[model samples]
Target: MFALLFSITIEAKEIEEVVVVGAYVAEDIAEPTEDNILETIQPTKTFMLGGFNGIQLSGTDTKHTGVFKNGVPVNDPSSGWYDFGHDLSTGQKVTVITGANSVRFGSGSMAGVVLLEDNFGRSLFTQIAEDETKAMVEYDYFQIAYYKGTQGSVKSTNTENDWYENKTFKAGYDIFNIELIDYYYEYDTCYDSNFAVSDDCSVEGEKLNVSIDHDRFTLGYTNNKSTHNTGYDMESDRTYADITLVDMLGHELGISGQKETYGERERETYSAYYIWSNDNVSVGYRYEEDEHIVRLGLENDGLRFSVGNSYRLPNLYEQFGDSWVSANPDLLPEQGYGAEIGNDWVSLYYYEFSEGIDFDMNSYSYVNTGSYISKGIRFQNEISLDKGSLFVYSEFTDSDKLRVPDYRTKVSYKYLGFNVEYLGEFDKGADFDGREIDDVNTFNISFSWYPDFATEIKIEVEDLLDNKYEFIPDYNSGGRRLKLSFNTIL
Candidate 1:
């Protein structure tokens, strides 16, 4: 009874103006064109720049949002933060929403959301074997990566130390209705001078999912566990059950419940929703309730809007740690209400002069009565021709004084099957009491090529101007660097 429609619109004419969904375009005409447009639109800094690797370019204290494999909610019971470091292989698509977006999402969506889908193509191994439809007998993929960097500046003496390692594995079995995925990540960093700081972090987790389908209904369960070690060690375990009612007023009704435990803090959430679509509009509402928590959401077309309120209960660390040296024992859980509104649109066919052009934009705002209010804007555009394409984007955030530039502009073009790009970041400086802080600027270029029946090759030169832009205050030293990479499918 629940009907879900998936459709793709193909434009026959040439591309003219390109627009990216949930993205932004900078005001500068000199900005590079090859930059990844997603970075310009989404609120977070984490983005896939072609390879399996993604860059967490900038840091923001906002909640990240992500979608389930089937476009369902992947809610977080504790802090409502979406962990982007997890395995992304299951994701068919990823969209990052920036800033306070309560009006568009719900109460706790003070930061932004990351929407994910599971319909993307298979990995190299899956494609080569041509067996993506059937489960593999054994895990068939593996990869390893390592990185190191340093920093230097004029305002403050400093040293940079950072490193990371990551691994992932996946397998499935049809007989048992089982699928498994495991992920691990480790990172360490040290900064002395300017502002003394040191952090050592590691995270490891696995997810086991099982489902059973019948004539009228479906049932599924998922078990997830993750361990984190930073200044302190913490572990989280979650179990969830989902049910689908096939015949519910010409629509599919879904209900889910989850229980999560972290240290001495425990919480439970229950949610239910109905989805259906016609030729013109798609509509649905989701309702969720738990201890000190209540949320509801509505959706139509490419827009999902929601609102809710929640109360944070004190955790074991906050309720018992020493105040003088350790955690604060008197800390209170954050409580607030929020809402969000958003949408996405694509053109099947438009004017000829605008051939190969696409456009996308999103703007949102949110307020926490007990905390702070925030707003953000993101836009992206792409234009494609016979030779290649061009991309442009921009992002901006406004607080009390618009203290940070946070704005970025980029462009990319392709010719003869080769792609090139340029990127730039705006100056984000603030007048602390009265004195003006120095703002930084940066420029980078990269090229990639693919030959017949061979691997893809890439070369990049960063900080071309050698401008001492401080990604973090006085923590300069990104400096100039050249990088090369090669990728092939077996």
Candidate 2:
């Protein structure tokens, strides 16, 4: 799974390297350091599709990926998919990890993990209590951003608008912390009325999240509900609690648990886990869905290796649903084991580069539609220059049925106050309905400008070439589209 860390401190440097995943990091806080995350998240990948930034590992569909907001799994319980459509205005840094699973996760992370963290709590209060030695009453962070997207093709029938806002209030008590996030989004599609179809189809949704931490323990909750004009609506709620402990040997220990309610059926499910870690070794065990998961890892200097086996519970739709022809409730949970080893390379224009390979064998992969063994090799490189910086990422995966890009790449350049980035993917065709589909190649480009340290305006264009091919049958590409967003701190 992926992890996101929000840092408010900016290293003292001249040419700060900037990287943007789902959230953007400026030069002020982009310099790498012993304690900074600049080097760890050097190469960032994000996709802007429809109304939100899609996951690179899941293609256009987000269900193939698992997402966690502040260590709590947020995928829809009924579908086990995350839209990634919510506004990240409350966050400062967003990280996505691929090809590895950590003790922090339970199920639904076969593809990878998406992490969203924020500094709204620390930055908002730490500033008011600026006196390094005292706590003050001044504390709060609020932001509002508007997003609009329009289809570029004249024949297009898609449009989107979103209004998002967040507020964080702290009392500077240091003993307790609470933060809340609220988001509302809506999108519309036009259908041919002549064919007895609804002229306009719209979907509206809202999400509310609350997190409270006291001392060494934290409790979090998320409620997400949505409605559709086509009579398909759903709601998912999740609650999680976790605590940290330190043993006599100075090793850290963590215990956490989660419970979720799926659909109106109200079927409840839960999971629990405990993990312990020292300087160079870590071990964890978790229980969920009548399955046991064990994880082991070791790290020394710049070399690291890890191996783990976990199971994914079948989503609500997979067990009992009328949308599909044959929804089987007896389907078994998907289980798999993964292993990886890598080393960081220093002393080059590329501050940090890592070459690693992993293998995952699944007994019953829900997304892949069956059992299969997949092997993947990952490569990451980043270069910092005087005027700008360059980052590169490539991965090769060998699998059957599941359609994943054979290779992908991203490029970024920052000069003066403007940033330009591009991401592209190359995927081989997968057989469907007794026919060999054509290979699909897609690319997206984004241009953003920072008027100041706290404000940014961005314009992004997806599917620049307007490729009409679809990864799945009947799922027509939305062609070329434009999205404009304005964000700032208040």
Candidate 3:
């Protein structure tokens, strides 16, 4: 059985950005490949500004369904790993939908699906404050960051030893009416030396949002923690509330609820959605219930669909202790049912092509009767180069053995800015233990110069001609590199 269909369409005049459901939203999708480019989009691995409301998607692998903010279901619950780049900041906006459209966000979507939108409208330091409730408490903002990177042979006899480090901190506040968020993250890695891994994460939260002009409402709580070095320590504490009603007759309604505790394992969820629009066309429906869980979804613009059924009653490392990292204590609590479909389109004018392009294509399929199933295809193209822009993307997946071909071509001919890329993974028809393996390639090249004000600097020389490839199976992924970055914005 072989089903592979590829398509591409382009029409550009881009300018659509401001749709932060849980944070990052930018129009025109597709451009990634560096071993599946953070596994096929969904915030391209991570970026964030606010925390939770409605809209949620998560995946990395190991079938564990996620999505729900006011109704609490951001997963992890012990090795489900929905890390979404650990609380993104810096003008946050993220949207990723990888591998099988993640069944539109229900039932572990098999290594893909991430949608985070949290930008809570209007900012520029709240337009100079002094008015809208004191500019929401003196326009608050905070950030702390640290990053370090290194890869292979820096010349010490070549057996290859890698390195990576990241530390982040962010804080936000909107006083008087209350809105606060705090985040912390830590990741450390060292490969080829056999074993060295560390991941630490934290999130603390509060929200009581309310807006009156177009109508809005919110209530929230989140306290989450993850610690792992292999010993794995997981904790989740949740509480939630949400309400949204917008009417001019065109209608829009949303309601939410949540309560979760992991340690002893406890659960609860509730959801509701409704919509009607005016423009071209729009429609929506959503329903959710909790205890054992149930969900239903439908939407229209191009299309969006959803269906869910769940029954998971056993947790706390699956009925108590003996954690060798976890699982199997009579393990059973993964019941299922799933569905999702999607399509999107935008064109201002297109007949032959003059000099404008923005196109997107997405396809997804999923099935789970006992446990796992997935199917995926994604394509995207964007071109507009006078100052900066050129992107191409392609993705294909069935499940796991992961093969990706990614290319990003960029040019800015003045002040010398150029980029050429080819990201790897090609196992053709893979099989293990029975033999058939040989097809791997990885490549990258980059150059930049911005020589002027607002403090700009760039120097990147990655994998220029060193390719030893093997992205996740005895490790050893790409080599030879030099990167330097500097930016200033106030």
lDDT of 3: 0.35
Model 3: which ten-residue window has the lowest total lDDT? 126-135
Candidate 1 lDDT tens digits, 207-261? 5544333333334454556554533444545565556655354455666666666
In candidate 2, which residue pairs get closer than 3 Å at backbone N, Cα or C atoms, i.e. clash?
none
Q: Residue 177 lDDT in model 1?
A: 33
Any idea how many clashes model 1 has? 54
The digit string of per-residue lDDT tens for model 3 on 1-490 reads: 0111112222211112111111112332222111111233422211111211112222113324243332234554433334433332323334543222122233333233444323232222111111100011112333443333334322223444333333443333331121232333222232222345322222232222211111254444555554444445556665666556554565566666566666666677666656554443334444553332333334455454444444333444443432332333454454544444444321111011011111111211111123343334444455666866766544344432222222112222222466655544444343333334334443455565556654344555545676654433333445555555444333
lDDT of each: 0.38, 0.46, 0.35
Residue 446 miss distance in model 3 (angstroms):
7.7
What lDDT score is found at residue 490 in candidate 3?
Answer: 38
The 10-residue segment of model 1 with minimum total lDDT is 349-358
Each model's total of backbone clashes: 54, 0, 23
- C-alpha-based local distance difference test score of model 2: 0.46
Candidate 1 has an lDDT of 0.38
Better of 1 and 2 by TM-score: 2
User: Using Cα atoms with residue i matched to residue i, what is each candidate's TM-score against the true structure?
Assistant: 0.57, 0.67, 0.26
